[model samples]
Target: MPDSLDPSLPRIFLSAGELACPERPSIITTVLGSCVSLCLWDRVRCAGGMNHYALPYPFTADEEPNARYGAWAIEGLYECLLEQGSRPAHLEAKLFGGAALIPAPQAQLDIGGRNVALGLSELRRLGVPLKARRTGGQHGLLLHFRTDTAEVLLRRAGG
Candidate 1:
Protein backbone atom coordinates (compact mmCIF):
# COMPACT_ATOMS: atom_id res chain seq x y z
CA MET A 1 0.00 0.00 0.00
CA PRO A 2 2.98 2.27 0.36
CA ASP A 3 2.89 3.44 -3.24
CA SER A 4 6.08 5.45 -3.14
CA LEU A 5 6.42 6.51 0.50
CA ASP A 6 5.83 10.26 0.95
CA PRO A 7 8.75 11.66 -1.03
CA SER A 8 9.66 13.75 1.98
CA LEU A 9 9.85 10.88 4.43
CA PRO A 10 13.21 9.35 5.03
CA ARG A 11 13.75 6.14 3.07
CA ILE A 12 16.12 3.62 4.53
CA PHE A 13 17.54 0.42 3.17
CA LEU A 14 17.96 -2.05 6.00
CA SER A 15 21.02 -4.14 5.41
CA ALA A 16 21.63 -7.40 7.22
CA GLY A 17 22.74 -6.87 10.81
CA GLU A 18 20.82 -3.58 10.87
CA LEU A 19 17.76 -2.34 12.70
CA ALA A 20 15.71 0.85 12.48
CA CYS A 21 13.16 2.29 14.89
CA PRO A 22 12.62 5.94 14.36
CA GLU A 23 10.37 8.12 16.42
CA ARG A 24 8.99 9.69 13.24
CA PRO A 25 7.51 8.00 10.21
CA SER A 26 9.75 6.61 7.48
CA ILE A 27 9.94 3.88 4.91
CA ILE A 28 12.27 0.96 5.54
CA THR A 29 13.20 -1.51 2.85
CA THR A 30 15.28 -4.66 2.61
CA VAL A 31 16.10 -7.63 0.43
CA LEU A 32 16.07 -11.17 1.73
CA GLY A 33 17.47 -14.51 0.69
CA SER A 34 17.73 -17.10 3.46
CA CYS A 35 17.88 -14.14 5.86
CA VAL A 36 15.02 -13.12 8.14
CA SER A 37 13.46 -9.79 9.06
CA LEU A 38 11.22 -9.14 12.04
CA CYS A 39 8.88 -6.17 11.57
CA LEU A 40 7.16 -4.69 14.61
CA TRP A 41 4.61 -1.98 15.23
CA ASP A 42 2.73 -0.72 18.27
CA ARG A 43 -0.75 0.28 17.25
CA VAL A 44 -1.37 2.25 20.38
CA ARG A 45 1.71 4.35 20.01
CA CYS A 46 1.82 4.31 16.21
CA ALA A 47 5.47 3.39 16.34
CA GLY A 48 7.15 0.78 14.19
CA GLY A 49 10.52 -0.84 13.72
CA MET A 50 12.30 -3.56 11.73
CA ASN A 51 15.37 -5.78 11.92
CA HIS A 52 17.32 -8.02 9.57
CA TYR A 53 19.47 -10.95 10.57
CA ALA A 54 21.49 -13.40 8.54
CA LEU A 55 21.96 -16.14 11.09
CA PRO A 56 19.74 -17.87 13.62
CA TYR A 57 22.17 -17.57 16.52
CA PRO A 58 25.42 -16.06 17.48
CA PHE A 59 28.51 -17.84 16.28
CA THR A 60 30.33 -17.81 19.62
CA ALA A 61 29.70 -17.27 23.28
CA ASP A 62 32.01 -14.30 23.37
CA GLU A 63 30.55 -12.70 20.30
CA GLU A 64 29.20 -9.25 20.93
CA PRO A 65 25.50 -9.78 20.48
CA ASN A 66 23.86 -7.47 17.93
CA ALA A 67 21.21 -7.31 15.23
CA ARG A 68 23.07 -9.87 13.11
CA TYR A 69 21.49 -12.73 15.09
CA GLY A 70 17.82 -13.54 15.49
CA ALA A 71 17.70 -13.30 19.29
CA TRP A 72 19.53 -10.02 19.45
CA ALA A 73 17.63 -8.51 16.53
CA ILE A 74 14.24 -9.32 17.97
CA GLU A 75 15.21 -8.00 21.36
CA GLY A 76 16.69 -4.88 19.88
CA LEU A 77 13.67 -4.11 17.73
CA TYR A 78 11.27 -4.67 20.63
CA GLU A 79 13.32 -2.51 22.93
CA CYS A 80 13.61 0.21 20.33
CA LEU A 81 9.85 0.35 19.92
CA LEU A 82 9.45 0.45 23.66
CA GLU A 83 11.77 3.41 23.85
CA GLN A 84 9.51 5.18 21.40
CA GLY A 85 6.71 5.12 23.98
CA SER A 86 5.00 1.96 22.82
CA ARG A 87 3.62 -0.46 25.37
CA PRO A 88 4.75 -4.07 25.19
CA ALA A 89 1.20 -5.32 25.06
CA HIS A 90 0.40 -3.21 22.02
CA LEU A 91 3.13 -4.56 19.78
CA GLU A 92 2.13 -6.42 16.60
CA ALA A 93 4.62 -8.37 14.55
CA LYS A 94 5.06 -9.23 10.86
CA LEU A 95 7.71 -11.69 9.71
CA PHE A 96 9.30 -12.11 6.32
CA GLY A 97 12.25 -13.62 4.41
CA GLY A 98 13.96 -16.97 5.23
CA ALA A 99 13.73 -18.33 1.73
CA ALA A 100 15.70 -21.45 0.78
CA LEU A 101 17.05 -19.73 -2.31
CA ILE A 102 19.61 -22.44 -2.93
CA PRO A 103 18.88 -26.15 -2.94
CA ALA A 104 19.85 -28.10 0.12
CA PRO A 105 20.26 -31.83 0.46
CA GLN A 106 18.11 -33.78 2.91
CA ALA A 107 20.84 -34.01 5.52
CA GLN A 108 22.01 -30.45 5.17
CA LEU A 109 20.79 -27.91 7.64
CA ASP A 110 17.97 -25.69 6.37
CA ILE A 111 19.20 -22.28 7.35
CA GLY A 112 16.00 -20.66 6.16
CA GLY A 113 13.85 -22.94 8.29
CA ARG A 114 15.99 -22.38 11.36
CA ASN A 115 15.83 -18.63 10.90
CA VAL A 116 12.04 -18.70 10.65
CA ALA A 117 11.78 -20.97 13.69
CA LEU A 118 13.96 -18.71 15.78
CA GLY A 119 11.93 -15.63 14.78
CA LEU A 120 8.61 -17.26 15.64
CA SER A 121 9.83 -18.56 18.98
CA GLU A 122 11.30 -15.23 19.93
CA LEU A 123 8.10 -13.36 19.08
CA ARG A 124 6.15 -15.82 21.18
CA ARG A 125 8.58 -15.38 24.01
CA LEU A 126 7.97 -11.62 23.88
CA GLY A 127 4.22 -12.03 23.78
CA VAL A 128 3.92 -10.18 20.49
CA PRO A 129 0.99 -11.26 18.33
CA LEU A 130 2.02 -12.10 14.80
CA LYS A 131 -0.27 -10.16 12.47
CA ALA A 132 1.23 -11.05 9.09
CA ARG A 133 3.94 -12.97 7.31
CA ARG A 134 5.34 -13.89 3.90
CA THR A 135 8.12 -16.36 4.23
CA GLY A 136 9.72 -19.57 2.98
CA GLY A 137 10.10 -20.33 -0.70
CA GLN A 138 12.76 -20.78 -3.36
CA HIS A 139 12.80 -17.14 -4.44
CA GLY A 140 14.14 -14.05 -2.72
CA LEU A 141 11.90 -11.13 -1.71
CA LEU A 142 11.95 -7.36 -1.68
CA LEU A 143 10.11 -5.76 1.24
CA HIS A 144 8.98 -2.21 1.88
CA PHE A 145 7.69 -1.33 5.35
CA ARG A 146 5.96 1.89 6.31
CA THR A 147 6.78 2.89 9.85
CA ASP A 148 3.81 5.20 10.28
CA THR A 149 1.12 2.72 9.32
CA ALA A 150 2.92 -0.59 9.76
CA GLU A 151 1.93 -1.51 6.23
CA VAL A 152 4.21 -3.71 4.19
CA LEU A 153 4.49 -4.23 0.45
CA LEU A 154 6.34 -7.31 -0.74
CA ARG A 155 7.44 -8.45 -4.18
CA ARG A 156 9.51 -11.39 -5.32
CA ALA A 157 13.06 -10.30 -5.86
CA GLY A 158 14.15 -10.08 -9.52
CA GLY A 159 10.61 -10.83 -10.64
Candidate 2:
Protein backbone atom coordinates (compact mmCIF):
# COMPACT_ATOMS: atom_id res chain seq x y z
CA MET A 1 0.00 0.00 0.00
CA PRO A 2 1.12 3.55 -0.63
CA ASP A 3 1.25 6.51 1.71
CA SER A 4 -1.78 7.90 -0.04
CA LEU A 5 -5.18 6.46 0.78
CA ASP A 6 -6.98 5.42 -2.38
CA PRO A 7 -10.35 7.03 -2.69
CA SER A 8 -11.95 3.74 -3.74
CA LEU A 9 -11.12 1.89 -0.56
CA PRO A 10 -14.16 0.91 1.44
CA ARG A 11 -14.79 2.84 4.62
CA ILE A 12 -16.27 1.47 7.81
CA PHE A 13 -17.21 3.31 10.98
CA LEU A 14 -16.24 1.47 14.15
CA SER A 15 -18.34 2.08 17.23
CA ALA A 16 -17.70 1.40 20.88
CA GLY A 17 -18.06 -2.29 21.81
CA GLU A 18 -17.22 -3.29 18.26
CA LEU A 19 -14.19 -4.63 16.35
CA ALA A 20 -13.28 -4.93 12.68
CA CYS A 21 -10.80 -7.13 10.79
CA PRO A 22 -11.27 -6.90 7.10
CA GLU A 23 -10.08 -9.50 4.61
CA ARG A 24 -9.56 -6.78 2.01
CA PRO A 25 -8.25 -3.25 1.93
CA SER A 26 -10.50 -0.87 3.83
CA ILE A 27 -10.47 2.28 5.94
CA ILE A 28 -11.80 2.13 9.49
CA THR A 29 -12.78 5.38 11.15
CA THR A 30 -14.04 6.15 14.63
CA VAL A 31 -14.42 8.89 17.21
CA LEU A 32 -13.34 8.57 20.80
CA GLY A 33 -13.55 10.19 24.17
CA SER A 34 -12.87 8.09 27.27
CA CYS A 35 -13.22 4.99 25.11
CA VAL A 36 -10.08 3.41 23.68
CA SER A 37 -9.26 1.98 20.29
CA LEU A 38 -6.43 -0.42 19.57
CA CYS A 39 -5.14 -0.91 16.02
CA LEU A 40 -3.10 -4.04 15.36
CA TRP A 41 -1.45 -5.24 12.19
CA ASP A 42 0.90 -7.93 10.95
CA ARG A 43 3.84 -6.28 9.20
CA VAL A 44 4.65 -9.42 7.25
CA ARG A 45 1.13 -10.41 6.26
CA CYS A 46 -0.21 -6.95 5.58
CA ALA A 47 -3.28 -7.75 7.63
CA GLY A 48 -4.75 -5.54 10.33
CA GLY A 49 -7.73 -4.91 12.58
CA MET A 50 -9.16 -2.44 15.11
CA ASN A 51 -11.26 -2.52 18.29
CA HIS A 52 -13.15 0.11 20.27
CA TYR A 53 -13.67 -0.61 23.95
CA ALA A 54 -15.45 1.61 26.47
CA LEU A 55 -14.20 0.16 29.73
CA PRO A 56 -11.11 -1.51 31.10
CA TYR A 57 -13.09 -4.45 32.46
CA PRO A 58 -16.45 -5.66 33.62
CA PHE A 59 -17.45 -4.15 36.98
CA THR A 60 -19.34 -7.26 38.10
CA ALA A 61 -18.70 -10.97 38.20
CA ASP A 62 -21.91 -11.76 36.38
CA GLU A 63 -20.90 -9.76 33.33
CA GLU A 64 -20.09 -11.88 30.31
CA PRO A 65 -16.75 -11.10 28.71
CA ASN A 66 -17.27 -8.94 25.61
CA ALA A 67 -15.65 -6.37 23.28
CA ARG A 68 -17.01 -3.48 25.34
CA TYR A 69 -14.20 -4.21 27.80
CA GLY A 70 -10.52 -3.60 27.08
CA ALA A 71 -9.24 -7.10 27.80
CA TRP A 72 -11.79 -8.81 25.63
CA ALA A 73 -11.49 -6.21 22.88
CA ILE A 74 -7.74 -6.57 22.65
CA GLU A 75 -7.84 -10.35 22.64
CA GLY A 76 -10.70 -10.45 20.18
CA LEU A 77 -8.92 -8.14 17.71
CA TYR A 78 -5.74 -10.23 17.99
CA GLU A 79 -7.64 -13.44 17.33
CA CYS A 80 -9.38 -11.89 14.37
CA LEU A 81 -6.11 -10.88 12.75
CA LEU A 82 -4.62 -14.31 13.44
CA GLU A 83 -7.59 -15.98 11.80
CA GLN A 84 -6.98 -13.67 8.84
CA GLY A 85 -3.55 -15.33 8.53
CA SER A 86 -1.49 -12.94 10.64
CA ARG A 87 1.30 -14.40 12.75
CA PRO A 88 1.87 -13.29 16.31
CA ALA A 89 5.56 -12.56 15.76
CA HIS A 90 4.75 -10.08 13.01
CA LEU A 91 2.16 -8.11 14.94
CA GLU A 92 2.55 -4.37 15.65
CA ALA A 93 0.12 -2.06 17.38
CA LYS A 94 -0.98 1.58 17.53
CA LEU A 95 -2.96 2.82 20.56
CA PHE A 96 -5.41 5.68 20.52
CA GLY A 97 -8.23 7.45 22.45
CA GLY A 98 -8.17 7.52 26.29
CA ALA A 99 -8.87 11.21 26.51
CA ALA A 100 -9.96 12.86 29.75
CA LEU A 101 -12.89 14.74 28.29
CA ILE A 102 -15.11 14.79 31.35
CA PRO A 103 -15.35 17.95 33.43
CA ALA A 104 -13.92 18.55 36.90
CA PRO A 105 -14.87 16.05 39.60
CA GLN A 106 -16.12 13.53 37.07
CA ALA A 107 -12.84 13.80 35.16
CA GLN A 108 -11.03 12.75 38.31
CA LEU A 109 -12.68 9.37 37.96
CA ASP A 110 -10.01 8.72 35.31
CA ILE A 111 -11.70 6.18 33.09
CA GLY A 112 -9.41 7.42 30.31
CA GLY A 113 -6.35 6.73 32.40
CA ARG A 114 -7.57 3.25 33.22
CA ASN A 115 -8.30 2.61 29.56
CA VAL A 116 -4.81 3.71 28.52
CA ALA A 117 -3.18 1.59 31.21
CA LEU A 118 -5.11 -1.54 30.28
CA GLY A 119 -4.42 -1.03 26.57
CA LEU A 120 -0.69 -0.77 27.15
CA SER A 121 -0.65 -3.77 29.46
CA GLU A 122 -2.69 -5.91 27.08
CA LEU A 123 -0.43 -5.09 24.11
CA ARG A 124 2.60 -6.06 26.16
CA ARG A 125 0.92 -9.30 27.26
CA LEU A 126 0.27 -10.12 23.60
CA GLY A 127 3.92 -9.36 22.77
CA VAL A 128 2.90 -6.69 20.26
CA PRO A 129 5.23 -3.73 19.90
CA LEU A 130 3.44 -0.38 20.03
CA LYS A 131 4.54 1.52 16.93
CA ALA A 132 2.71 4.72 17.80
CA ARG A 133 0.03 6.32 19.95
CA ARG A 134 -2.03 9.48 20.55
CA THR A 135 -3.42 9.26 24.05
CA GLY A 136 -4.14 11.30 27.19
CA GLY A 137 -5.64 14.78 26.92
CA GLN A 138 -8.74 16.78 27.79
CA HIS A 139 -10.24 16.43 24.31
CA GLY A 140 -11.70 13.74 22.09
CA LEU A 141 -10.08 12.24 18.95
CA LEU A 142 -10.97 11.09 15.49
CA LEU A 143 -9.04 8.26 13.85
CA HIS A 144 -8.70 7.01 10.31
CA PHE A 145 -7.06 3.59 10.14
CA ARG A 146 -6.00 1.86 6.96
CA THR A 147 -6.35 -1.89 7.47
CA ASP A 148 -3.99 -3.23 4.82
CA THR A 149 -1.29 -0.60 5.20
CA ALA A 150 -1.44 -0.19 8.97
CA GLU A 151 -1.33 3.57 8.64
CA VAL A 152 -3.24 5.80 11.02
CA LEU A 153 -4.30 9.42 10.74
CA LEU A 154 -5.37 11.04 13.99
CA ARG A 155 -7.03 14.38 14.60
CA ARG A 156 -7.70 15.98 17.96
CA ALA A 157 -11.37 16.66 18.23
CA GLY A 158 -12.22 20.14 19.59
CA GLY A 159 -8.90 20.39 21.34
Candidate 3:
Protein backbone atom coordinates (compact mmCIF):
# COMPACT_ATOMS: atom_id res chain seq x y z
CA MET A 1 0.00 0.00 0.00
CA PRO A 2 1.14 3.57 -0.63
CA ASP A 3 1.60 6.04 2.18
CA SER A 4 -1.40 8.30 2.55
CA LEU A 5 0.79 11.38 2.41
CA ASP A 6 2.79 10.26 -0.59
CA PRO A 7 3.94 13.24 -2.57
CA SER A 8 2.76 11.73 -5.82
CA LEU A 9 -0.62 11.07 -4.25
CA PRO A 10 -0.87 13.22 -1.17
CA ARG A 11 -3.81 13.67 1.14
CA ILE A 12 -4.20 17.43 1.56
CA PHE A 13 -6.26 19.06 4.27
CA LEU A 14 -7.43 22.60 3.54
CA SER A 15 -8.81 24.55 6.44
CA ALA A 16 -10.46 27.97 6.32
CA GLY A 17 -7.00 29.46 5.84
CA GLU A 18 -5.25 27.00 3.53
CA LEU A 19 -5.09 25.30 0.10
CA ALA A 20 -3.09 22.37 -1.33
CA CYS A 21 -2.58 19.85 -4.20
CA PRO A 22 -0.52 16.92 -5.41
CA GLU A 23 1.72 15.92 -8.34
CA ARG A 24 -0.50 12.91 -8.78
CA PRO A 25 -4.10 12.44 -7.83
CA SER A 26 -4.85 13.47 -4.19
CA ILE A 27 -7.60 14.23 -1.77
CA ILE A 28 -8.42 17.76 -0.67
CA THR A 29 -10.87 18.43 2.12
CA THR A 30 -12.49 21.42 3.88
CA VAL A 31 -15.38 22.54 6.07
CA LEU A 32 -17.73 25.43 5.43
CA GLY A 33 -21.00 27.12 6.40
CA SER A 34 -21.57 30.59 4.95
CA CYS A 35 -18.07 30.68 3.50
CA VAL A 36 -17.47 29.21 0.03
CA SER A 37 -14.93 26.81 -1.48
CA LEU A 38 -14.09 26.32 -5.15
CA CYS A 39 -12.46 23.15 -6.40
CA LEU A 40 -10.63 23.38 -9.74
CA TRP A 41 -9.64 20.39 -11.82
CA ASP A 42 -7.84 19.80 -15.11
CA ARG A 43 -9.50 16.74 -16.53
CA VAL A 44 -6.88 16.07 -19.17
CA ARG A 45 -3.92 16.40 -16.87
CA CYS A 46 -5.62 15.11 -13.77
CA ALA A 47 -4.23 18.07 -11.81
CA GLY A 48 -6.30 20.37 -9.65
CA GLY A 49 -6.67 22.29 -6.39
CA MET A 50 -9.20 23.65 -3.88
CA ASN A 51 -9.71 26.80 -1.79
CA HIS A 52 -11.85 27.84 1.20
CA TYR A 53 -12.59 31.50 1.73
CA ALA A 54 -14.62 33.34 4.31
CA LEU A 55 -16.11 36.56 2.93
CA PRO A 56 -15.38 38.55 -0.23
CA TYR A 57 -12.93 40.48 1.86
CA PRO A 58 -11.81 41.24 5.37
CA PHE A 59 -12.41 44.89 4.49
CA THR A 60 -13.58 46.83 1.47
CA ALA A 61 -9.96 47.76 0.68
CA ASP A 62 -6.64 48.43 2.42
CA GLU A 63 -6.97 45.01 3.99
CA GLU A 64 -3.91 42.92 4.81
CA PRO A 65 -2.49 40.92 1.91
CA ASN A 66 -3.16 37.63 3.70
CA ALA A 67 -6.84 38.41 4.19
CA ARG A 68 -8.94 35.43 3.08
CA TYR A 69 -11.39 36.41 0.36
CA GLY A 70 -12.94 34.89 -2.77
CA ALA A 71 -11.03 37.01 -5.28
CA TRP A 72 -7.63 36.40 -3.75
CA ALA A 73 -8.44 32.79 -2.96
CA ILE A 74 -9.46 32.01 -6.55
CA GLU A 75 -6.48 33.79 -8.03
CA GLY A 76 -4.09 32.02 -5.74
CA LEU A 77 -5.56 28.62 -6.47
CA TYR A 78 -5.46 29.23 -10.23
CA GLU A 79 -1.88 30.40 -10.13
CA CYS A 80 -0.78 27.50 -7.99
CA LEU A 81 -2.25 24.99 -10.41
CA LEU A 82 -0.84 26.80 -13.41
CA GLU A 83 2.60 26.86 -11.85
CA GLN A 84 2.20 23.13 -11.53
CA GLY A 85 1.60 23.01 -15.33
CA SER A 86 -2.19 22.79 -15.40
CA ARG A 87 -3.72 24.75 -18.26
CA PRO A 88 -6.62 27.13 -17.83
CA ALA A 89 -8.64 25.76 -20.75
CA HIS A 90 -8.70 22.34 -19.17
CA LEU A 91 -9.90 23.69 -15.84
CA GLU A 92 -13.33 22.80 -14.46
CA ALA A 93 -14.87 23.86 -11.17
CA LYS A 94 -16.98 22.50 -8.34
CA LEU A 95 -18.33 25.14 -5.96
CA PHE A 96 -19.56 24.57 -2.43
CA GLY A 97 -20.65 26.55 0.68
CA GLY A 98 -23.04 29.38 1.50
CA ALA A 99 -25.47 28.16 4.11
CA ALA A 100 -28.18 30.23 5.75
CA LEU A 101 -28.03 28.45 9.07
CA ILE A 102 -29.85 31.04 11.11
CA PRO A 103 -33.61 31.35 10.87
CA ALA A 104 -34.90 33.32 7.84
CA PRO A 105 -36.14 36.25 9.92
CA GLN A 106 -32.66 36.70 11.37
CA ALA A 107 -30.68 35.49 8.34
CA GLN A 108 -31.81 38.39 6.19
CA LEU A 109 -28.38 39.83 5.51
CA ASP A 110 -27.16 36.58 3.94
CA ILE A 111 -23.43 36.87 3.73
CA GLY A 112 -23.54 33.24 2.71
CA GLY A 113 -25.56 34.10 -0.34
CA ARG A 114 -23.10 36.84 -1.20
CA ASN A 115 -20.22 34.43 -0.92
CA VAL A 116 -21.87 32.00 -3.30
CA ALA A 117 -22.58 34.68 -5.87
CA LEU A 118 -19.08 36.09 -5.68
CA GLY A 119 -17.54 32.67 -6.03
CA LEU A 120 -19.57 31.89 -9.15
CA SER A 121 -18.88 35.25 -10.78
CA GLU A 122 -15.17 34.93 -10.17
CA LEU A 123 -15.07 31.47 -11.70
CA ARG A 124 -17.06 32.66 -14.69
CA ARG A 125 -14.75 35.62 -15.22
CA LEU A 126 -11.85 33.21 -15.30
CA GLY A 127 -13.74 31.18 -17.94
CA VAL A 128 -13.83 28.02 -15.93
CA PRO A 129 -16.70 25.60 -16.39
CA LEU A 130 -19.05 25.59 -13.40
CA LYS A 131 -19.54 21.86 -13.38
CA ALA A 132 -21.57 21.47 -10.19
CA ARG A 133 -22.53 23.31 -7.00
CA ARG A 134 -24.20 22.84 -3.65
CA THR A 135 -25.06 26.11 -2.01
CA GLY A 136 -27.79 27.93 -0.08
CA GLY A 137 -29.20 25.99 2.83
CA GLN A 138 -29.34 25.97 6.64
CA HIS A 139 -26.45 23.58 7.21
CA GLY A 140 -22.67 23.40 7.03
CA LEU A 141 -20.76 21.12 4.65
CA LEU A 142 -17.76 18.84 4.62
CA LEU A 143 -16.23 18.50 1.13
CA HIS A 144 -13.76 15.98 -0.19
CA PHE A 145 -12.06 16.15 -3.58
CA ARG A 146 -10.48 13.19 -5.32
CA THR A 147 -8.03 14.65 -7.75
CA ASP A 148 -7.31 11.40 -9.55
CA THR A 149 -10.87 10.85 -10.60
CA ALA A 150 -12.04 14.43 -10.27
CA GLU A 151 -14.73 13.33 -7.87
CA VAL A 152 -16.27 15.55 -5.20
CA LEU A 153 -18.09 14.30 -2.16
CA LEU A 154 -20.19 16.71 -0.12
CA ARG A 155 -21.62 15.69 3.23
CA ARG A 156 -24.06 18.02 4.89
CA ALA A 157 -23.96 18.47 8.61
CA GLY A 158 -26.51 16.26 10.46
CA GLY A 159 -27.59 14.71 7.19
Candidate 4:
Protein backbone atom coordinates (compact mmCIF):
# COMPACT_ATOMS: atom_id res chain seq x y z
CA MET A 1 0.00 0.00 0.00
CA PRO A 2 3.05 2.27 0.36
CA ASP A 3 6.55 1.94 -1.10
CA SER A 4 6.90 -1.74 -1.78
CA LEU A 5 8.16 -3.03 -5.16
CA ASP A 6 7.50 -6.67 -5.94
CA PRO A 7 9.97 -8.13 -8.37
CA SER A 8 7.49 -10.68 -9.62
CA LEU A 9 4.87 -8.25 -10.81
CA PRO A 10 4.36 -7.44 -14.47
CA ARG A 11 5.58 -3.95 -15.34
CA ILE A 12 4.71 -1.53 -18.11
CA PHE A 13 6.77 1.52 -18.96
CA LEU A 14 5.06 4.55 -20.45
CA SER A 15 6.95 6.84 -22.76
CA ALA A 16 6.07 10.48 -23.19
CA GLY A 17 2.69 11.20 -24.77
CA GLU A 18 1.31 7.87 -23.59
CA LEU A 19 -1.44 6.66 -21.27
CA ALA A 20 -2.27 3.24 -19.90
CA CYS A 21 -4.96 1.45 -17.95
CA PRO A 22 -4.11 -2.22 -17.94
CA GLU A 23 -6.77 -4.91 -17.79
CA ARG A 24 -4.72 -6.84 -15.25
CA PRO A 25 -2.65 -5.89 -12.26
CA SER A 26 0.73 -4.42 -13.20
CA ILE A 27 3.61 -2.44 -11.93
CA ILE A 28 3.05 0.43 -14.34
CA THR A 29 6.27 2.38 -14.43
CA THR A 30 7.96 5.37 -16.08
CA VAL A 31 10.90 7.75 -15.75
CA LEU A 32 10.66 11.48 -16.09
CA GLY A 33 12.43 14.83 -15.83
CA SER A 34 10.90 18.12 -16.88
CA CYS A 35 7.89 16.07 -17.88
CA VAL A 36 4.79 15.15 -15.87
CA SER A 37 2.90 11.96 -15.15
CA LEU A 38 -0.47 11.49 -13.51
CA CYS A 39 -1.27 8.37 -11.49
CA LEU A 40 -5.06 8.05 -11.40
CA TRP A 41 -6.78 5.42 -9.28
CA ASP A 42 -10.39 4.34 -9.45
CA ARG A 43 -11.78 3.32 -6.10
CA VAL A 44 -14.84 1.49 -7.34
CA ARG A 45 -13.07 -0.73 -9.84
CA CYS A 46 -9.95 -1.09 -7.73
CA ALA A 47 -7.98 -0.31 -10.89
CA GLY A 48 -5.53 2.43 -11.82
CA GLY A 49 -4.17 4.28 -14.86
CA MET A 50 -1.24 6.51 -15.69
CA ASN A 51 -0.19 9.16 -18.19
CA HIS A 52 3.02 10.88 -19.25
CA TYR A 53 3.07 14.26 -20.91
CA ALA A 54 5.84 16.62 -22.09
CA LEU A 55 3.97 19.90 -21.87
CA PRO A 56 1.06 21.11 -19.81
CA TYR A 57 -0.76 22.88 -22.65
CA PRO A 58 -1.04 21.88 -26.28
CA PHE A 59 0.32 23.90 -29.21
CA THR A 60 -3.25 24.73 -30.26
CA ALA A 61 -6.03 24.67 -27.68
CA ASP A 62 -8.73 23.68 -30.15
CA GLU A 63 -6.94 20.89 -32.01
CA GLU A 64 -8.57 18.12 -29.97
CA PRO A 65 -6.61 17.24 -26.87
CA ASN A 66 -4.92 13.86 -26.60
CA ALA A 67 -2.24 12.18 -24.50
CA ARG A 68 0.62 14.33 -25.80
CA TYR A 69 -0.28 17.40 -23.81
CA GLY A 70 -1.26 17.64 -20.14
CA ALA A 71 -4.68 19.03 -20.94
CA TRP A 72 -5.37 16.17 -23.29
CA ALA A 73 -3.42 13.66 -21.25
CA ILE A 74 -5.70 14.17 -18.30
CA GLU A 75 -8.71 14.06 -20.56
CA GLY A 76 -7.61 10.93 -22.40
CA LEU A 77 -6.61 9.07 -19.29
CA TYR A 78 -9.90 9.81 -17.59
CA GLU A 79 -11.82 8.84 -20.70
CA CYS A 80 -9.89 5.61 -20.98
CA LEU A 81 -10.60 4.75 -17.37
CA LEU A 82 -14.26 5.59 -17.79
CA GLU A 83 -14.46 3.36 -20.83
CA GLN A 84 -12.92 0.62 -18.72
CA GLY A 85 -15.64 1.03 -16.07
CA SER A 86 -14.57 3.70 -13.63
CA ARG A 87 -16.78 6.40 -12.21
CA PRO A 88 -15.70 10.01 -12.27
CA ALA A 89 -16.96 10.61 -8.75
CA HIS A 90 -14.94 7.75 -7.27
CA LEU A 91 -11.56 8.80 -8.64
CA GLU A 92 -8.48 9.99 -6.78
CA ALA A 93 -5.08 11.06 -8.07
CA LYS A 94 -1.39 11.01 -7.30
CA LEU A 95 1.00 13.23 -9.23
CA PHE A 96 4.66 12.68 -10.10
CA GLY A 97 7.64 13.98 -12.17
CA GLY A 98 7.89 17.66 -13.30
CA ALA A 99 11.54 18.11 -12.49
CA ALA A 100 13.81 20.89 -13.68
CA LEU A 101 16.39 18.64 -15.27
CA ILE A 102 17.81 20.51 -18.25
CA PRO A 103 20.43 23.20 -17.77
CA ALA A 104 19.00 25.55 -20.34
CA PRO A 105 17.72 29.02 -19.60
CA GLN A 106 14.92 29.73 -17.13
CA ALA A 107 12.59 28.73 -19.92
CA GLN A 108 13.38 25.08 -19.30
CA LEU A 109 12.55 25.26 -15.60
CA ASP A 110 9.53 27.36 -16.43
CA ILE A 111 8.20 24.60 -18.62
CA GLY A 112 8.53 22.11 -15.81
CA GLY A 113 6.75 24.46 -13.45
CA ARG A 114 4.01 25.02 -15.97
CA ASN A 115 3.53 21.28 -16.28
CA VAL A 116 2.92 20.93 -12.56
CA ALA A 117 0.72 23.96 -12.37
CA LEU A 118 -1.46 22.98 -15.28
CA GLY A 119 -1.84 19.43 -13.99
CA LEU A 120 -3.09 20.72 -10.65
CA SER A 121 -5.42 23.21 -12.24
CA GLU A 122 -6.88 20.80 -14.75
CA LEU A 123 -7.53 18.15 -12.14
CA ARG A 124 -9.19 20.78 -10.00
CA ARG A 125 -11.33 21.97 -12.86
CA LEU A 126 -12.44 18.41 -13.58
CA GLY A 127 -13.17 17.77 -9.88
CA VAL A 128 -10.62 15.01 -9.28
CA PRO A 129 -9.17 14.98 -5.80
CA LEU A 130 -5.36 14.81 -5.59
CA LYS A 131 -4.29 12.54 -2.78
CA ALA A 132 -0.49 12.53 -3.00
CA ARG A 133 2.43 14.01 -4.93
CA ARG A 134 6.19 13.75 -5.43
CA THR A 135 6.81 16.45 -8.01
CA GLY A 136 8.73 19.68 -8.56
CA GLY A 137 12.41 19.28 -7.77
CA GLN A 138 15.77 19.43 -9.52
CA HIS A 139 15.90 15.68 -10.30
CA GLY A 140 13.99 13.01 -12.14
CA LEU A 141 11.77 10.26 -10.75
CA LEU A 142 11.11 6.57 -11.25
CA LEU A 143 7.49 5.62 -10.61
CA HIS A 144 6.17 2.15 -9.87
CA PHE A 145 2.42 2.03 -9.60
CA ARG A 146 0.74 -1.09 -8.29
CA THR A 147 -2.42 -1.38 -10.30
CA ASP A 148 -4.13 -3.92 -8.10
CA THR A 149 -3.90 -1.97 -4.90
CA ALA A 150 -3.70 1.45 -6.51
CA GLU A 151 -0.52 2.19 -4.59
CA VAL A 152 2.64 3.87 -5.87
CA LEU A 153 6.34 3.76 -5.11
CA LEU A 154 8.22 6.83 -6.28
CA ARG A 155 12.02 6.99 -6.23
CA ARG A 156 13.96 10.14 -6.85
CA ALA A 157 16.18 9.07 -9.70
CA GLY A 158 18.43 11.12 -12.02
CA GLY A 159 19.08 14.82 -12.26
State the lDDT of candidate 2 residue by residue for 1-159, as single tens digits.
345567689988999999999998889989999999999988998878899999999989799989999989999999998887888999999999998876547644899989999999998898999999989888899888998898888888764
- The root-mean-square deviation over C-alpha atoms between each candidate and the true structure, in angstroms, is 1.4, 2.2, 3.5, 2.5
Error of 2 at 35 (Å): 0.7
**Residue-wise C-alpha lDDT for candidate 1, range 30-131, written one tens digit per residue:** 999999999999898777989999998987899998888998999999988887788999999999999998788862478888999999999989999999
Against the hidden reference, what TM-scores do the models get?
A: 0.95, 0.93, 0.87, 0.88
TM-score of the candidate numbered 3?
0.87
Off by over 4 Å in 4: 1-4, 61-65, 103-109
Stretches > 4 Å off in candidate 2: 1-3, 104-108
Give lDDT per model, in order.
0.90, 0.90, 0.81, 0.86
In candidate 4, which residue pairs clash? none
Between candidates 3 and 4, which one is better according to lDDT?
4
- Candidate 1: give its CA RMSD in angstroms: 1.4
Between candidates 2 and 4, name the one with more favorable lDDT.
2
lDDT of 4 by residue, 1-159 (tens): 454557777889999999999978888999988889998899888888899999987777577756879988988988888999999998999988888776658664577788999899989988999999888878999888887787787777852
**Model 4 deviation from the true structure expressed as Cα RMSD, one decimal place:** 2.5
lDDT of 3 by residue, 17-114 (tens): 56665676788878889888888998888778888888876665777654268878888888889999888999999999999877566544788888
